[model samples]
Target: MTDCDFLVVGHGLAGATLAYVLRQRGYRVLVFDPGQADSASNVAAGLINPVAGKRFALTWNANELLPAAASFYRELEQCFGQQFFFEAPIFKIFGSLDEQSALLTRSPDHPWGDYVASLATTDPGLPGVQAPLGGAWLRHGGHVLVRELLAALAAQGEREGWLWRETFDWTKLVTDPTGARYAGRVQARHVICCEGAAATQNPYFNWLPLTPNQGEVLDVECAGLSSAQVLNRGAYVVPVGGGRFRVGATYRWPPFADGPTETARQELSGRLAAITEQPFAVVGQRAGVRPAVRDRKPLLGPHPTVPSLSFGGGYGSKGVLLAPRLAGLLADWLEGKAELWPEVDLRRYAALYRPAAGS
Candidate 1:
């Protein structure tokens, strides 16, 4: 008999949530993670915005994903007796009158209108903010305390003897139709890789187009800023309590590198400046590579030939808002309770998989 029903690799948002869902479904799970400080989930601001981007369009599947995310995190909160999800309004400061008019015109009739809490034609009266063109207060938006949630899950997993603090070694993994064995000591009926950006290097599934991108964020102390709401202009300033805010994310593609860069710090600082005139001091900076997919959709499902091996990652910047719901869907698929949605199913890319030499 296998030691566990599923062995999950990586304890970031994707793996942690998947493991929890599986366990709730009565499956024994073992999560392996070395707790990499630079993992994308750890560095993410955990911002949950239903509307985003230059067009300010509703996020894909926002209607379903947002509610699922809230319920999942709330259940975890009740289970752990610790709060991780924070619901607050996001103030989207418009850069120009055209932008303001566009949202004002569409918000009244568009489906995205449901998420618009209010709109202002004049400055929203936010201190230290530059919003001459006014803005929109988007409801159902907030940030998650990601690290805290991960820690709580890990603590519980550790206490239950299901969490292993070690890096997953590909060479030590053996898989077949029946199951997978790790280092000849742990046997699991199935193995799922949730390795974030690192999955691009996964020998079995790297053939899929996993475009990892580097992103950076800065932690700053802005004394006058309101801690009750998120301010979004070109860059987002998320209040993290005690007058400290997480300001981020500069996106860089290709030629990815590790560690924070001075260029990114300056870019973030500049964006923060554009958002607010309040004096602030940069206290910290973090950098991580986001596991983005070619089509900007999450990758999920088992290897074509190796049924025992599976993958669940590439949620990109939307991991926090998307992981929980997708985790449930993945668990459902695993138990043969339902089929994966066609778009996210790995079978969509089956033609791209070419067996490695000597495989």
Candidate 2:
């Protein structure tokens, strides 16, 4: 049997970043993932926005999380000799005059001042965007090439002999007071489930209020649009080099539908039309389910009863920005260097875990 310090199940953003953090700290880490193409990390736009929703409220803990994520991605870029993170400004178009007035009403001394790079009251001249009410130029926001980053991390892990391209079979996993053994081939000092939306299916973590949310996006070729910044209204249009842009993100809550749908395509296309007058061709469509939680906070820390087994998911749409920093904290907690932040600690929901009958 191969011995390791951590056996991480799933190689999505949460798993990949956590494993990288743990391995960097000199732990023997093994990662298992079947490489689902539709996994949230693979399909996510990897947007790092500090402000959210129609109210334009600052994202939860943006001041701390944003900078940490930027630094973390930069460190990875230095290590891999590849650029995966792109720092770009987000042009948030105002939906109406009321919306524009509301944003302007916030004083310059408002907490959001730090993130506001600029504000416009008239059409900000972009090639074909239809922002007559103008928009806000949000700084310290951008996108990460999530799929490429995960692949790079997986390659490095493989070269170091710690990543496996296979599904983690629950039937073959044996957990006890000491640790966890998998398929009789690998024994780990601790096991962490970073499975994204699939965590709802994990017997160990199923009790957690993990709600799977389906989201879809479209890849389009818009020759008229510039790739300098991301354009957002109800949906977003993210430039991905050349004349190609990724548009979308239609959210579908449970009683979940499967795969890309014609309805979603029309919805996104309509939003795209509202954002720009530029004619674009739909090149591709992709969909994935986000691992959301009841409280909308990430799930971290060990299982209430099974102390050696832990979880690190429920990042939902903010995985790209939240994962890196939270991974470090999880590592610190695992190493007994610190405590898990209360908001994210799984103990917040410990009352939900009821042991199986006669287990």
Candidate 3:
């Protein structure tokens, strides 16, 4: 058995980022991943949009989260010596004059307007594309190659003797006043559950509201297409070099399953047609289940009754943009450097966990 400072379960964006943060803070960390369920971060394109939607509104907490995510990922890339994060601008293609008019109606001096990188009254003349109404370039918008990121993060952890490739068992977990013992193989000061959707089944964190949302994306090869900016209207077409683009993703509530559906592929292809007249060949399609909360806030902080247990999950689609910042916050809280944000605190939903009406 080996002792450590922190044991993180689930190597998805949530777990991996938290492990990286804790490791950076000089904490002895061990990470475990059970490939028993779908991970939303695996197939995530990692697109970070500042100004989004038809109204060209800023993404939630863009002003603060954007810069933090930017610097955080940049430093990670340099530290890991991998080409994982791509800094690119997203172009919001206008479908109609009303869309453009409504966007212009908002004062540029507004706080949200700071994220609008730029806009053009006329089309930017992207080849094989039909943006007759032009589009706007959003700043602080980019993507992290999630698959590469997780792999690189795990490799780094392994190099530091902080990563394990095995399934963590709940029955073997025993928590005392000081720390936790896992199957007598690993001992840790705290056991944080970053198990994504599987957190819904965790005995310690199961009470928290976690909704599984399924999303799908298609990888395609198109010749003679510009490999510059990300284009978005109803769907997004992101160039991944070599004239290939990863276009996706269909967001469905009450997800039927965590697998690619024919319906989603057809829907994505249909939407991709709006980006350009150029025909493309579909190479592959993938899907994963994202962990979302009822209030759309992150699920973080230590277990209410177990000080040696902690949790960080429910990042949903914004995992790339939210994970770094949230991990820092959680790490700080764990080290007694800060308090957990009320919006994301697990205690907020304790009422549901408590026995009801004098049971």
Candidate 4:
């Protein structure tokens, strides 16, 4: 039988990070990654902004999550010998007078004090971007090349005899009090499902709420536009150097079309126009679905019934920030070195698995 300490399903950021940490800690790991078509992490912009959205509220756990994620990626860059982690500032352009006024009230003494690096009322002067109202420089905000990093991690796992390329069939997953045996060939002490949005298909953990967020992005080349920082308004324009940029992301539910749609393209084009006054051409466009959790936090821990099974997914757009620290925590918990964080623990959803209160 193909044996290992853990059997991790799915290789998206969540699973990948967990596998990486487990491997580092001297645990044997075997990963089953089908490399599905709509893998959201592959198309993600990987933006790690501590504060986001129109309200400019700080992410739930930004203070501790951001620095931990950054440290992981920085070390990953050195380990992989690639320049995938880019630590740069994100310029959040103020949309109107209301937004500027709100930010003005959010001085250094506010709850968001430490996250705000600097606030400016002067024009940013990004060539293609229009900046009449100016913006704020969010310190330590940056993007990671998620697709490339996953590839590098997979290659390393392969060399270490832990990477497998195949889709897991749930019917073949045989479990008992001790562990699980899959496909009649693989055995492990525990099986963790990090399927991202695709966990909805898992017969065991599909009960957890995992709403799909369809997003579309564009890859365009603009010769004259110059900028190093990520621009966020309603949409974001990330400079990929060589006069090319990655832009456009529309969120929708029950995603009608599996691929890019003309409607989203027009919407993004409108956002581009609103962000920039200069002329630019859209070169390419792609779309993927994010697993936006119902509670706006990751779904972590084991199945209520199956001792050998657990889950780690539902990161949504904040995977870049949430994955690293959570991965370590999951590894520690799985190895019996620590307890699962209460907030993300699957036990919170215990009511769902129970029958009606009086019944």
lDDT of 2: 0.91
lDDT of 2 at 129: 87
Instruction: Give the C-alpha lDDT of model 1.
Output: 0.91
lDDT of 4 by residue, 75-151 (tens): 89999889887887888998898889888887645767577778878786777778788888888788888889998
Off by over 4 Å in 4: 354-359
Give per-residue CA lDDT, model 1, range 199-309, as digits (tens).
878888888889989999999998987777899988889999998999989899978666899999999999998888889999999999999999999999989889899
TM-score of 3: 0.94
lDDT of 3 by residue, 215-253 (tens): 999999989666688889888888887889999777887
- CA lDDT scores, all candidates in order: 0.91, 0.91, 0.83, 0.85
- In model 2, pairs of residues that clash are none
Q: What TM-score does candidate 4 get on C-alpha atoms?
A: 0.95
Cα deviation of 37 in candidate 3 (Å)? 8.9
Which residue ranges in model 2 land beyond 4 Å of their true spot? none
After superposition of all CA atoms, the RMSD between model 2 and the true structure is 1.1
Please give the lDDT score for candidate 3: 0.83
For model 2, state the Cα shift of residue 356 in Å: 0.6
